[model samples]
Each structure stands twice: as C-alpha cells, then as structure tokens.
Target: MPTKPPLIHVLHPGLFTTVQDLGRCGYQRFGVSVSGAMDPWALLVGNRLLGNPDRAAALEITLHGPELLFEQALTIALTGADLSPTTNGFAIPMWTVVAMQAGSRLQFGTRRQGARAYLTVAGGITGPMMLGSLSTHVRSGLGGLAGRAVKKWDQFCVGPAPRTAAQSIGRSLLERYRPRYTKSPTVRVMPGPQSDYFTDDAVQLLTSSSYRVTTESDRMGYRLEGAELPHRASAEIVSEAVCVGSLQVPSNRQPILLMADCQPTGGYAKLATMISADRSLAAQLAPGDSLSFRMISAQQASELFRSHHAELDRILPPCCS
Candidate 1:
C-alpha cells in the first residue's frame, strides 16, 4: 500500500487563512485578478526555509493565525509578522524551521507587526488551481480550496517529506534578509501617465502630505484618506490597465492603492504608481497607519527596483551548489 500523506485539521480559523502561491500571471487579458500572497517577501522566506521553489504555494495567515492539529510528523516554517507561534506549548522561531510530531497542536498568538504570515511545508501545498494559481481571491469567489478563507474542520494534505530534515537558519542570513517594518513607510512613486490630468497643487499634495490607511482596505485595494487631490480636467479617462501598485484616485478624491486582487482597468485618474520594489511595504501597512509617497523618475525607480532584488538575491542560498 502507498504511504498515507500527513493531514492538518483546522481547529480555529484565525482571522483569515488563504492558500497562495506567487500569483496568477498571463491571464489578466481575460480579466482575471493576479491574487497571491500579500507579502511576497514573507512567502519567499517561508519557501526558502523548506527548500521549496520560491514561488511554491503556502498558507497565508492574516492578522491572527489558526490553531491546527497534525496527523503526522512534518517540517514547516512560518514567516511574516511576529505571531508568537508555538507547537505543543514550545515556542517556535520565525524565519526558521520546526518539526511537528503527530497529534501535536500548533497555534499562533497575536500579531506584533504587519498583518499576514506565510506557512510553508517541504513539498508545497498541493491544491486545485483557477486560472493557473492556487491563490484565493475571496471577493471574486475564485481560486483557493473553495474560493474563500479556510474554515474550521477544513483539512489539508501534505506531501512526503524531503530527504533532508529541517534545520536552523543561520543568524547572519536572518540579520541580512528581513524586510524593515516601519510605522510610517515612505513608498517610492513614479508619476503616472494621467498625472497631467491633476492640478499642480493636487500633485504636490500627493507627494507632500501623509495619508492614513482606511479600515475599508482589503486584498483588492487599500483606500487612503488624506489630502484630497483636485483634477484639472474633471473629465473621465478611458479605463486602462492597472497593476499591483497603481494609485487610482476616484471621483471622491480618495486614493486607492491597487493591490494583489485589484481589477485590470479603472476610470479613476492615476496620480502615481508605487514602485514594484516598495510594494511589499504597502502590504504591511495596517489600517490607520500613516504613509507618504516620494516621487522618483521612472528610470531611477527601475534601478532601485533592480538593486532591491539584487540585495535579496545575495542573502538567498544558492539553489544548486
């Protein structure tokens, strides 16, 4: 008989738990959202701990995390947020590895920084995909286990363990790799194609004034309440493709930062776009946190983005060495 896979049963569903991979790409032409882990850095770290591919599927835990019971021994890693996680009453280190024995109970406490956490196992979380991704887009009712957050009694299967056992990550690696979580994040921005539509004062306010994240934020977008920007030509622009960092200012004058599940197109005038490199900072901003945008030339933004990736690459161990 084939060996049975380990099973994880959810006892408490935490604040929210969703299955996520890198993202659904190439289907935006079909109007599908590119939903994935909100904090990609955290997801990558979790996968690195397990020696899985960088884009492998992992469980994205939001705010509070769930309580689970394991049916068999397995290696897992938790990244993002200081959730004070424990296994069978023993504390487990973040950005590292842990071995859970059969019947052992795993739980996470309150979050200290950021909102989400990524839990990755050795062989990745196997699941059905919608439009080439296992990520959950709850608002659209697509992807994930059933187009929603993991619920109580929900069970997930784990693949066979890798030949190498989980081990402690080096302190030097941890010191050099983690992203800095700030109370007030300054996100780099590039002026948008529609920036000319806004009055000079509006543009100045966008870069000068600080904004507070609203409670209405979600995976689709983060609505910011701050300096109300006025448009020079109140006329609507044709809907154009919006990406993960597009700052769309609706008629109400409030700016909404498009996120992982944002629509492909919108009518709002885009004042600026947060650079792809700083997007992970946006992911960590909780409601009521302050944020500011610093304008940078597109060329400069691209260079900074590339440099950021290179810095991260330096910390990652060689995959084939």
Candidate 2:
C-alpha cells in the first residue's frame, strides 16, 4: 500500500491565520482586492530557503500565530515578524531553515516585534487555487481555506517535500538582509493621484506627525489617528481605482492606509501613496503602533523600489524560476 500524503493539523488557530501566495493580479477592474502575504519579501525568502518558487503558497500569521502539527518530517523556514515561534517545546530561530520531525508541533508565543510572520514548508502548502492564486480575500470569500481564517482542527494537505530541502535546513539569512520590525517605523511615500485635493499644510502634517494605528484596523485598511489632513475641497471623490498603500482621507479627516486586503476602489481623497517598497512594512504595524511618513519624489521612490527588490533577491535566490 502507498504511504498517505503529509498533512498539517491545526491544533489551535491564532488571531488570523491564512494561506497566501503572491496574490491575485489584474482583476481590479472588476473590483478584486489583491489579498496576499503582508510581507512578500519575507514570504519569498522562506520559500526560497526551502528550495521552492518565490510565489509558493505559505501560511501567513498575523499578530499571533497558530499551533500546527506536522504529520510527516519536513524542513521549514520562518520569516517576517518575530512572533516567538517554537517547535515541540523548543524555541526556533527565524530567517533560518528548521527541521521538523513527524508529529512535531509548531507553536507561537508572545509577539516580540513585527505584526505578521510567514511559515514556509519544504514544498509549500497545496490547496485549490482561485484566479491563479491561493491568497485569502476574506471580505469577498474568494480564496484560502474557504476564504477565511484557519479554524481549530482544520487540516491542510501539503505538497511533496523538496529534494534539497533537508540539505538547506541549517542555512540562514545574513543579518543585514533580515528586516527589523519596530514599534514605530518611518515609511516613504509619494504624491497620490489626488494629492492636489489636499492642502499643503495637510501634506506637511502627514510627513511631520506620527499616526497611531487604531484597533478598528484590519487587512483591509489601517485607520490612523493623527493630525487631520484637511482637504482643499470636497472630501469625496468619484469612486476611483485604489491600490494598497493609498492614504485616503475621509469626511472626518482621518487617513486610512489601504492595505493588502483593501477594496479595489475607494471614494476618498488620497493625500499621498506609500511607495511599493514601504507598503509591505506597513503590515508589520500593530494596533497602537505609531508610524510616520516621509515624502519623496516619484523618481526616488521608483529607484528605491528597484533597489529593494534587488536586495531581496540576494537574501534568498529561488532554487528555480
């Protein structure tokens, strides 16, 4: 008889555990949010560490993390937020490949730094894909494990372990390449499509003052409490295409930073848009955490984005394209 396939048994589901990949792209015209890993660089690093493709599906843990029991021996990697991960009662290190024995339980404790983390197995997680991706867009119930967070007792069918996965178990990323999660982070931004709608003072306040992340924040957007961004005219705009990192100011003047699971379109005036390079870092911010924005020219932002990806590629080159 053939051996059964390996599985991941969820013993305790944490705050918001979901399976994610690179995310769905090119569907925003019909109003589709690109829901994926909060930190794609972290996910990519873990995937590459395990000899998997950069877009391999992995588990994305937010704030807290879940306890999972592996049904078979496999190598894994943890990246992103330092959520105090442990395996079978022993603490495990992040940004490094760790070996898990059959029936071993991986768990998380206190959230020391970042707001999210990624758990990448040797061959990544296998599941039904939607729109060519496996990311979870919970608001619309589109992807992931039934388009929702993993529940207690839930089990996931894992893919075949990578051939070189065992050999890379002890490998780890260099210190410089690993990201540092801070309670207060400064992110770079550029003029938005509707930047002119906001007064110069509003833009200055945004860049000069810090905003506190509100509890009401979620994958959709971060409700920031800070100096109100006064608009030049009406606060409303014709519902227009919005993407992650859009700093949309509404009637109350508070800015809402659109995130990974933000709606495809919004009707508020955006004062600025966080650059793509800094957008993922926005995910590491937790409620009560404060963040400041620094305005930069579009050219500078584009150059930074390119340099950022080049560094990420060096962190962990994919075993295959």
Candidate 3:
C-alpha cells in the first residue's frame, strides 16, 4: 500500500499565510507574475536549516502567524519575523531547527518585528506545481494550496524528512545571516530603463527624500507617500516589461516600488530599481515604516549582488553549494 503523506493540521491561519518558493521564472512574456516569498532570504535560511533544496516550498507567514498541529514527526525551522513563536506553550527560539513530536501544538503571539516570516519543514511542503513553481500568485489565483492563504482546518501534506543524519546545534543560523527589520533602512537603487523620462530633480528627490510606506502597499508594490517626482516631459511611458524592485512613477507623482507580485508590464515612467542586495530589507518594511534611497552605479549594484550571494553561501555552506 502507498504510505500516507505526513500532515499539518492548521488550527488557525493568522493574518495572511501562504506557501511560497523562490518564484516562478521565465513566464513574464506570457503575463505571469513571479509571486513568492516576500522575504526570500528568510525562506532560504529555514530551508537550509532543514536541509531542503532552495526551491522547496515553505509557509510565508505575514503580519500574524498560524497555529498548527503536526500529525507526524517533523523537523522545522523559523526565520525572518519574530512573531513570538511557542511550541506546546514553550517559547521557541527563532533561527534554529527544532524537532517536533506528533500532536504538539505550535502557536505565535504578537509580532515582535518584521512584516513576514518563513516556516520550513523537513523536506518541504507538498503541493501542485504550476509553471515550474509552487508559489501562489493570489491575485491570479494560481499556484500554492488552492492559490490562497491557508485557512483554519486546512491539512497540508509534508514531504518526508531528509535521509541524512539530522543536524544538532549546527542547524542554528549564524547571527550575520539574520536580517534586522526594526530600523528604518536606506535602500540602494540603480537607474531604471526609463530614467531618462524623468527630470534630473525628480531623481534627486527620490534619493534625497524620505518616504513613508502607505497602507495601500501589498505584495504587489510599496506605495510611498512623499515628495512628488515631476516628469521632464510626460509621466506616461510605453508599457514595458518590469521586474521586482522597479520603481514606477505614475501621474499621481507618488512612486510605487513594484515587488514580488508586481505585474508583468506597466505604463508609468520608471524611475529607479532597487538593488538585489536590499530587496530582502524592502520586504520587511511594514505600513508606516519610513525608508530612503541611495543611488548606486550599475557596476556597484552588480558587485554587491555577487557579494550578497557569496554571503548567503558562506552563511549556509551546506545548502547553497
């Protein structure tokens, strides 16, 4: 007989929790947005602790976190946001792998910091694969567990634990790998493809002024309320392909930084693009959080990108390689 898959019974699906991986790639021309973990670094850390591959699906917990009961033995790790998690009522440490007994309850209290967290089980979360990704594009209603945030009573199948010997204290993620979400961060950016469309002063305003994240922000984009960016000619530009971190300035003049769930194309004049090195920090910003931008040359951004990946590999040598 085929063995039954291990399950996790969700007692409560807090705020907005969904399954995510690295993201669906190479389908933008077909109009598919790469919707995955907003804080992918957290996801990577969790998976590394559990000895799972980089693409393994994990729970992306937002604002609040879910209460779960494991129906089978599991090894798990939590990363990113500190939601004050507890296992069977005992406080559990973040950035560490812990073995869980069957029937044990896992819960979260008030969010201490960070906007989103990641929970990775041994192996990974099992779900239908769409377009080579398990990530959920909620707006499109595609991928992940029925393409929605998990709900109470939802029972999810989990892959079997890794065959290799389990980690001891080595599963603890190093401090350097842990990201800080409590402070107002200055994000780095490079000129966008349509930067020429904007006035020189508009670009200066973006880099010089502080912006507050608005309540209208979501996984799709961070709408900032700050200095207006006037166009040199017109704010309208030919709809062009955009990517994660593309800063699109619409007619309203308030810039919206496109994110993980951003559309495939946009018509607004592009101002700047956040560097890959700072995307994780951008992911942790909550509503009302203040942030500023620093301009960097394309060469500097590329070098930083390489350095960031190197740091990840150093932090999790076993998994990143």
Which prediction has more favorable lDDT, 2 or 3?
2
**lDDT of candidate 3 at residue 68, scale 0 to 100:** 94
Give the candidates in order of TM-score, highest first.
Answer: 2, 3, 1
TM-score of each: 0.94, 0.97, 0.96
- Candidate 1 C-alpha error for residue 292, in Å: 1.3
Candidate 2 lands at a TM-score of 0.97
Mind giving the per-residue lDDT tens digits that candidate 3 earns over 1-321? 877888999999998889899999989899999888888888887887778888889998888889999998788898888999999889988999888888998999987888888888887898999999999999998888788889999988988767641764336887775788864789999989889988879878998889999999999999999999988888887788988999999889999999999989999988999998898888988898978999998999999999988888887855532
Query: Candidate 2, residues 240-275: lDDT per residue as tens digits?
Result: 888888999998999999988999988998888898
Candidate 2, backbone clash total: 0
- On lDDT, the leading prediction is 2
lDDT of 1: 0.82
User: Residue by residue across 199-285, what tens digits does model 1's lDDT show?
Assistant: 888778988999998999988899999999888877268887888899988888889999888987888889899998888788877
Per-candidate local distance difference test? 0.82, 0.89, 0.87
Cα RMSD for candidates in order: 2.0, 1.2, 1.5
